[model samples]
Target chain A: MLAMSASDESARSPGVLIVDDDAGIRENIADLLSTEDYRVYSAADADEALHVLEAEDIDLLVTDFQMPGRNGVELIEAARKANHLVPAILMTAYLYVYEQLDADRRKDITLLRKPFDADEILREIAARLGDGNAPKR
Target chain B: MTIPPAAGPKAPPSAGADSKPPGNRRTLFGATILIWAVTAGLGILFSVFAVAIGLQAATFDVMRWLLALAIEAPLAAGIIALIWYSRNMHSATAAGEAGAQALAHSEAKYRELIASAPDGIFVLDPQAKVIDVNGAGEELFGLSRAEIVGHSFMEFVPPERLESARSYLADRLKGLRATELYEATFAAADLKPLHVQLRSQVVRPSDAEPYVVYIVRDVTAQREALRNLVETERWASMGRLASFVAHEINTPLTNISLLTASISRRVSDPEIQERLKKIAAQGRIAANITGELLKFARPGAISPIETELTDLIRAAVEQTDAFRKPGVELRDETGTRSVVCTVDPMRIQEVFVNLLKNAYEATPRGRVRIRLQDLGSLVAVSISDTGSGIPPEIQSRLFEAFFTTKKKGEGTGLGLAISRNFVASHGGDITLTSEPGKGSTFTVVLPKQAPGVRATE
Candidate 1:
């Protein structure tokens, strides 16, 4: 299932995709991003996330590494295959999995180990999406 | 002479019918009586002859009769003496036969006792060659009596232990050792090492050379049991500590980080925001540590399933491949053969990944090798690295929680401790063999059947 939150100025705001198997985390991130004046799209698993990716124009991808069908890495790879050069953040409780990523794959991806707060996630998002002030085309 | 009967009523009842004189004594008495009668008859005949001659015969006839009677008496006494000598010889032969039967019976009883004893018994000649072995010895050595006898006892001892074994034997033989107990490793017929306790003594027979008798008890299982107990206790205490940290400290740390973030977002002052951020950052660090602790604490969540061991190991090797340095070579020696076991795949996979990652991290410019072996009742996976091996002092504490040789941010030190707990929950164990300057090998052995499941033949 998809949960979309668009502000009145969402047509000009950057769109962000949040994919996680956890409903609480996905909705919380969506709420945070929406309040920061970005349009938010959320999915509970890789399959739902894939549907949103095909249907929406997302400026950034924030995904969890461990999920039901495909992991965050595979989802990111799928997005890249579809010519979406959107920057991505991979959050995981398993740090070893992040260390196993090749240098090339790791270069474009930011890692957030679990139990992270809103500030860290917001900081990483701002770093990728340019302070969340101007909307990306 | 006449044979005298034994006094019937005066004889001890314990002697019973045997108290009577034997037939040989009666025959000797009869012979004596006949010989004396003949001697008397002959004397009478001689006297009559003298009287018939009628010339001053009275005195001379009497003297001649007396001489003849003396000669007859000596012959009769000699016959009796011969019969008595033969009777004594017969009795002595009967007694010797009874003694031989008793000795044979006693030897058979001792042989049975030795054969049935649970501990291995070895009778070694002074040269240390096995002259005799009991049934238990045969089972312990995994060899038959024919295969063991005449072989040097030293042959079963491992090469490194031969000196100590020889020393012990020599001391016992020379009576220099005050105690009869010693312990050592012995290689069985299959070349498997056995930990054994030996109680031995030297036996010197008057008619034969001195020999050593060893009573060997296999203590391999007992030693393993003791090591397992110590290991289990260590992990259990570590787990308790992890549980305490996760339960008591984790919730507060999380609240501190979340509340600080919430407050920082609302506050407009830059100074307050910066300080709150710092507090949040420290909370995150503490939370990270607690997160690892939770993983170590919660091993009972294992969901065991039938999984192929080689495939699991392969996945781990692949996962850790990215950690390999430029000049480090990773070798997968796990063959294509499928070795299936009941295990929690996620937990076991984590164990493999942890070990492999450590190997790759340690070997910056050498080789990292992983191999799988199917040991009938169990399976072993070994991860070896050609890196600077762990030192003796650090090796003992390698599996301790929060004990790390790595620089601060590189490790939390819970990887090995958690991995060991995971493997142990599966009724398996992890062992390390390392040489200071050479390298290290970590072996994880898992039972084919899960801990609570009954094993099938």
Candidate 2:
């Protein structure tokens, strides 16, 4: 579902795409960002998430580090190769899974542990967005 | 004859003097001593007679008198030497008898000790054949002493272990190894398999054959008990792992709370509203799963500090609210005032949650009340439910693990047992009071200040 943005379609709010195998978590992230009046995109897996990235003008990418196939890290790298630089946040239950990310790839990418509060998620997305089409607090 | 090994593989010099010699050399020595003694005695008697004859026959000549004096002095010395030799011979005979008696006494005592030993004792000769066995050994094989002796030890060892058992006995008897310890199955006289532990030691008796002395113990009962203890611990650990596969539960729970909160706010239509309630219901189920895991967990690492338990009690009540039957009231009678106690806040919360959950489970839609009190040194927390009370007979065994009044799939039956353990570990106790059809109350009494000796980091 396209989480309805509060503003008009002509100046669509900056888009944040959330990709996770879990429907509840994917929809909840979308649900959380929708309150900020930003257009939110939800995808069930990496294939679907990549499809959304291709179709939308996604400004921020939020993805779970572990998925059924081709985890969030691989998805973001693939997404970045196709087009422009999109800042990413990777949520994982295991922190050690991302410890080996090279110095170059670590830049503009944030690691978040799971079972996190929704407020924290909003803060990170806004920080990554800076003032450029940043969602309302 | 038994020669004590303390003498270093040789006969004592004093003992040899009294022992009978092996060959004609002994006869020669005896004859020589007799001849010398007799010659000395006869010389004494002849010297006396010669001295008398010389005195009677001699005139007052100086030469004759001198000769008579010399003869008399030599005879007196010979007689004195003979008397000393006779006294030595009598004492040697007495010493020999004493040594023989002492050897007899020690051998008898050793035999008695082996016969009365608790563990089966068997003496095996160099060929691994049983030379002798004690009374216990006979009982161990379920055979008479005559039947057990002169039998190869390999006959009693089960076929599967025969090779190892053979080599072990061979090594011990050859003195290649001083001792051998092993567990093996023994085929008793009735052909029943028995688990026996053998401790075999090499005993080399002086100048005699070496023997392997085995101390055998029937360890079947002991092994069974040890196996049961290990299995019980494994079952207990596996029991806790049931659905709270932590990470699996957490992701869904995180989604549950956030998505349900969002849906309930945005949607206003009755149809969507009904679906949102269902979302809340699933969310509550996830929350219950987390609470149940904590309720059964050892509260993780223990962190005890002085804190108000009232807050903890209220939090636990809130945690269990989702699981309570609809319309069942969990009234926390604890006032807002701090009921201070030194304890692991997490553990106390777990105990409270477990008790409240039990109360909620029993009372489908009735009232469950929690009351806390500070009686100077002791703090008492009581949970009472208006559900059907437990029977008098079953209530006594309520705290035992795997003993549950709840139907099979409903309970692991370990919750109360673990809760009671936690309470008791903190120098506290959980007491139960119940009447059939009148509901039940479980009271947990803890010291206001738990004496501190242990803490886990």
Q: Which number leads on DockQ?
A: 2
Estimate, for each residue in B1-457, the C-alpha lDDT of model 1 and write its tens digit: 0000011222221232332345545665666566656765665665555556535555765766665665665566556655765676477446545654654464456667778989998878778988788899999999998888889999888999999999888888899886556889999988888999999867665444666778999999999999999977876787777767665564355446556765765679999988987897788788777777768765444557899988888888788878989999888899998899999898899999999989888887889899999999999999999999999999999998789999987789999988988887788999999997678999999998887732110
Q: What is the overall TM-score of model 2 with all chains considered together?
A: 0.42
Give the alpha carbon lDDT tens digit for every residue of B1-457 in model 2: 2222222224331234225423333454465566666655665666565567667865545445555545654555555545644554455455656765765575566667767877898767778888777888899999998887788878888889999888887777666775656888898888877888889866565556766668898887888899999966864575457424646777877776677667666778889988877776666555554544434443333446797889889899899988799878877799887889998776778889888988998987788999999999999999999998899899888987667888765666767876886787677899999887778999999897886734211
DockQ scores of all models, one per candidate:
0.11, 0.23
What stretches of model 1 exceed 4 Å from their correct place?
A: A1-137, B1-78, B125-129, B144-147, B151-155, B158-181, B201-212, B255-282, B303-405, B420-457
In model 1, the clashing pairs are none
lDDT of 1 by residue, A66-98 (tens): 888999999988888888888899976555566
For model 2, state the Cα shift of residue A38 in Å: 5.0
Off by over 4 Å in 2: A1-24, A35-137, B1-232, B243-246, B249-269, B294-298, B310-339, B360-380, B384-388, B391-441, B447-457
| Candidate 2 chain A, run of 10 with poorest lDDT | A1-10
